[model samples]
Target: MTTPTRPPKTRRRPEWLVPAGLIALSLVPIVAGSARLTQLTTGAAVTAENARFFDSPVPVVTHIVGSSVFLVLGALQFAPSLRRRRWHRIAGRIVAPAGLLSALPALWMTVFYDIPTAVSGPGLAAVRLVLGTTMAAAILVAFIAIRRGDVRTHSAWMTRAYAIGLAAGTQVFVFLPYTLLAGTPSPVVYTLLMTAGWAVNLVIAEVAIRRRARGPRRRTGTTVTAAGARLS
Candidate 1:
């Protein structure tokens, strides 16, 4: 007679509080400034000034396609139905490719993108390239894992990757608090906020991987065991 072997125990990972904090952070711009939308736009590296690509109509195509990819993929993150149905299989088919396409334009656009996100100077280009490239790479790997039916690996990587993908909007808060309290210059605060955004999103991704690796637990049903012991 042999005892059943249990599944391997997984290491724990930290969960991000930012999603819940998103509401509070989102309010700062609205409460402090009359031009919430405009402020958000200023935070982006992309602007009307250097929006050219491939000599003719690259910006237009990138904007339209990238915007669509980001909008759809970001929305899919919090969607309970998709998560419940384990729809990553279906969504991955579309999302993985879209993310890849978006990354190219994001990296290319960085050439003309001179804005510093926090920490300052020429390093901004490196920061943008690294964040964009890592996100694209993660999705590609996760997509491959899913095609092979590696559910745990797939979910972990994809969720973490998506966290970075969604960081642009969430990053606004990292420095918004200090900006509000100190009343510092917009350029100074905006940069801090953006840098913090990417870092936090990466943390968010690690959290997702940890949570998913743990998976759902089976409900314990009360029962009587042998040897006069109670087991549930």
Candidate 2:
């Protein structure tokens, strides 16, 4: 029998869980990831100096360009006024080229990506390679869309592309709590998280934007019906 004086149990999730999940899902590498992922998480390309910080052949140009372009792209998403006010266009013009240059270096570096250990089948490696390539191609198409004045297509492609770019940040944020509680190795956990997260984020952005797009159309139809009723 429950006492009437008892307060209802709160079912609040911890605030830290969000960041922890992001880190767990994004930042870490596989049980044995390509050295590239290791390079990636350490902020390898955040600055030109990172070239010196990394191995020769220096993923420097790629890192610098990718980091900077993504920063701009990610910022534009949060500023609706800026997005609608032509500022996003001007910024997009600048970021699109920069993003392409960044990918040139990234795609070139793919050969060094290591396959997962203990999984002798080529499938795991193949999946990573394909997804990574697909992400690069999507960004390139997004850049082209902006240049062609296809704003709707640009917005959709860019959101998916930028979500992939932002995956690094989100991955770092996802890797903590789940990994801690689940007790997975740092590398395997990170790799799975980042790859899985890319797909998840892409789907989520598409669904959310589609919903927002549909909402305005629905409201417009409703308003037209109301106006017609008043006329009648």
Q: Runs in model 1 with CA error above 4 Å?
A: 1-64, 77-80, 84-88, 112-122, 184-191, 217-232
lDDT of 2 at 125: 51
Task: Output the lDDT of residue 199, model 1.
Answer: 81
| lDDT string, candidate 2, 45-81, tens digits | 6444334334534554455555455545545544555
Instruction: Give the residue spans of candidate 2 off by over 4 A.
Output: 1-53, 113-128, 186-190, 215-232
Estimate candidate 2's RMSD in Å.
10.9
Per-residue accuracy of model 1 over 6-124 as CA lDDT, tens digit each: 44555643223433354344343334322423434465344444233223345435534553554455445545445556584566677777666667677776766443343353455
TM-score of each: 0.62, 0.61
Q: Give the worst 10-residue stretch by lDDT in candidate 1.
A: 28-37
Estimate the lDDT of model 2: 0.55
Computed on alpha carbons, the lDDT of every model, listed in order, comes to 0.58, 0.55
